[model samples]
Target chain A: MHSWVDGQPVDSVPLKDRGLAYGDGLFETIAVKAGQPLLLDRHLQRLNEGCRRLALVADHGVIRSEVLAYAVALGDGILKLILTRGDSLRGYGLNPGAPVRRILQGSAPATYPPAHGVEGIRLFPCATRLAEQPLLAGLKHLNRLEQVLARAEWQDADHAEGLMLDMSGRVIEGVFSNLFLVRNGLLLTSDLSRCGVAGVMRAELLAQAQALGIPVVVADVSVEQLRQADEVFVCNSVYGIWPVRGCAAMSWPVGPLTRKLQGIVRALLDI
Target chain B: MHSWVDGQPVDSVPLKDRGLAYGDGLFETIAVKAGQPLLLDRHLQRLNEGCRRLALVADHGVIRSEVLAYAVALGDGILKLILTRGDSLRGYGLNPGAPVRRILQGSAPATYPPAHGVEGIRLFPCATRLAEQPLLAGLKHLNRLEQVLARAEWQDADHAEGLMLDMSGRVIEGVFSNLFLVRNGLLLTSDLSRCGVAGVMRAELLAQAQALGIPVVVADVSVEQLRQADEVFVCNSVYGIWPVRGCAAMSWPVGPLTRKLQGIVRALLDI
Candidate 1:
């Protein structure tokens, strides 16, 4: 892997980094193609919001330039950017004016079966329900044991992802992706105010759907509501979109809405 | 600082390690005195249980031996042991049969004001509530952004620790310690089934209280109940225990029960 910390080449991160100690960090996984990072602005925008919410000072200009330079050098792959509150003593208290550490690493894009996009993918209804924390919701901070546990729920290749729900039994998102339901031609997704990540692709889809004149509603979505949906899909910035074939007993066909969005996402990434 | 990964001396951890990437790990902070680690058995026991809960394969015997060897060499200090699911690709999915990474780091003990133990410390009512996550609860996993945020709520040196409540408005714990309330000579603490760390010190206190013939109750502790209590205190393995003098509008006296436990704890560690 090619890596850098705060623009300096480094083999590993310091053990005392707050990111490793308390998961006190924000991360972005960008899909790189032909030496270009897709949706770099969106990723940085989210990272900026995360820094604001966490009350950490971040130099977005430096982050943007560093990420672009790093990705361009890598040519084509997946680039992960982790911004931590820097190393601290053995306590929760933050060191005054601690420098923010920006780590950029690149890896080859993971190969997935084409069928995942064409024929859609199966999802496990993960027993690990996400806890409602509006304070930390929507930010792609490093505290992600919930997702790790939910993803570990299924080991079978037949299940491409796991569907996670909130404690109140509301359908939240995929283990690593944001969820969307197309019911009667309207784009519906869970309100992440309570829990779940609001992925970059999810935000793009919402905006694109509005531009395409497809109605969108950001509100509470139930399991039964998902079951009744005409089409279901999951999306992430790295993988684009994958139509949901089945989640537990409820099976979904790769509907026209899912295909249309997939085409748009492909074009978006290809650029 | 002295550090090691997988029994080999190291200065830093790989960025791809799951502990930094996804907080997929457990940790133990132990107090060492005169070439002896206080509560080595309890820390390892908790780590083993955490491994079981997370389904991560751990060699507890090896961990126990290494921790003791490392601590005894250091003699008197604080030792932090991090057990991660090890390095993996950039995703929530685990690498099957991946070796678990054990990280041991030792640092000098933290110095706090002597008044904090004798006169008690002030507490801040944190707005950041602890999310109810039973699966991840009670385990000192790396996912601790909630506590980081809670600890960040106070800038005043007067507030030694912030008191955090759950989403349901029930008092949970301090940002880094387990909370207890003494009401009518009975020790009351929040149940860890929903949320909160089951600190080794809290466990030790419970056992010692029972041995001392003080009634103990592990149940839901509301803010109102804490206000009505005669005494309130917080305990963690690293700092022993600190009595709570004030939180919001409710004030507590450093009652007899708290002082008794403090003396016993100091004796337990000193020997």
Candidate 2:
């Protein structure tokens, strides 16, 4: 494992950094393969949008260079980038002129059961409901306690992921990945305007689906609708895609759509 | 300025600390008066409740002793105690047996304009609405991007604090304080079961109000109700109480009840 803060090969951040104080920051998890970062554009785009929404000042070009340099050094791994509003005194007020802080951490590629993708996996049916907050929704900001709590709902090997719903009972995303369902041959994903992280892999898959002439819909998804889907799966930048075989009382087969999208993602991630 | 990480003097935290990674933590800001942490019991009670709700394991007895020792060494200042779910790899899943992290940072007592406290301060009507998440509401856990965004809404010194409302247009609290309004000599504060931090000063004042025979109501407070109030004020452990003169198109005089409560809080904080 290796880490860098502010482009320096360091493993810690200042205690007063606003990211630690109030989660006042943004993060991106990128898959690095053979010294190349997969889906780099989409990841940087999301990070830039997060900074814009949070009024955080940062130079995207510099960050891109840093990531490229870091990836080349690591060869192959998972690179996590954290950009914060920098350090501040004990207050919510920002120091208008403070420089933004950038941290890059690298780790060996994660390993998961091969059966998870080939045979699919079950979801824990999490009781934690995502709050609807359009202001902070979908940007991958550091305020992720909701996901932390949701992931804690189950600790068994039987469930590889958890299905999360919004406060209004609308099916959202997984605890960590963006979820998608295939119904009547249409690829559908929950609208993230109210909540959930807008994952880079999800965006890439949607784009690929359109290119392949597969009709895609991003709208509110109910658990009932999820249960009625022909196929279901979850996707994230790191894992590519994990087919959903079942969740609680419902079950689905690894249909053609899920397999096709997984192939595309697997190729993109070079996994 | 001084700091400690897990009882050891340090100025930084491990980059992988969940507090920095996902804001998986709870914090309390206490006013240290003459080497004594004011409202220590109330602060610890809130921390314990937050830890329970978040499923974050920590020993409160050890925490108390640490706070006491830190406070004595840095008399007459502001003490911030942050307890995180320790460090973990890149994931939301908890390390079931990982030790919790404790951080203490001390700074000089914050100074505010005397006029703002005595003659009352204007409030900035913030556009950032808090999301309703009962699971996280009222617990001063570290997911505070809402407060940061709300505080950023106004930088001018004219408005000392910003008034935040929930997504459904219910007045919740100040950006960094708990809001209260008085009408017909009855004291009222917004219900924080849906959103907002339950400030230690707010809790102490409510108890004090009950003891002093002051009528207190905790319910949904709309902006309309706030405008029609006879007086308005905000309270937090650090600064005691600051009378709110107006917000947006509304105005109010600092009434007798505000003065009475201010006296009590001032004595309690020993400021």
In model 2, the runs with Cα more than 4 Å from the true position are none
lDDT of 2 at A69: 95
Top of the candidates by TM-score: 2
lDDT of 1 by residue, B14-95 (tens): 8889988988899999999987889888888889899999988988888988998998888889999999999986588888
Where does candidate 1 stray beyond 4 Å? Answer: none
List, residue by residue over A154-217, the lDDT tens digit for candidate 2: 9899999999999999999999899999999999999999999999999999899999999999
TM-score for each of the candidates? 0.98, 0.99
TM-score of 1: 0.98
Interface RMSD of 1: 0.7
**Model 2 alpha-carbon miss at residue A238, Å:** 1.2
Give the per-residue lDDT digits (tens) of candidate 2, residues B67-129: 999999998899999999999865999987789999999999988888888999999999999
Worst 10 residues of 2 chain A by lDDT: A89-98
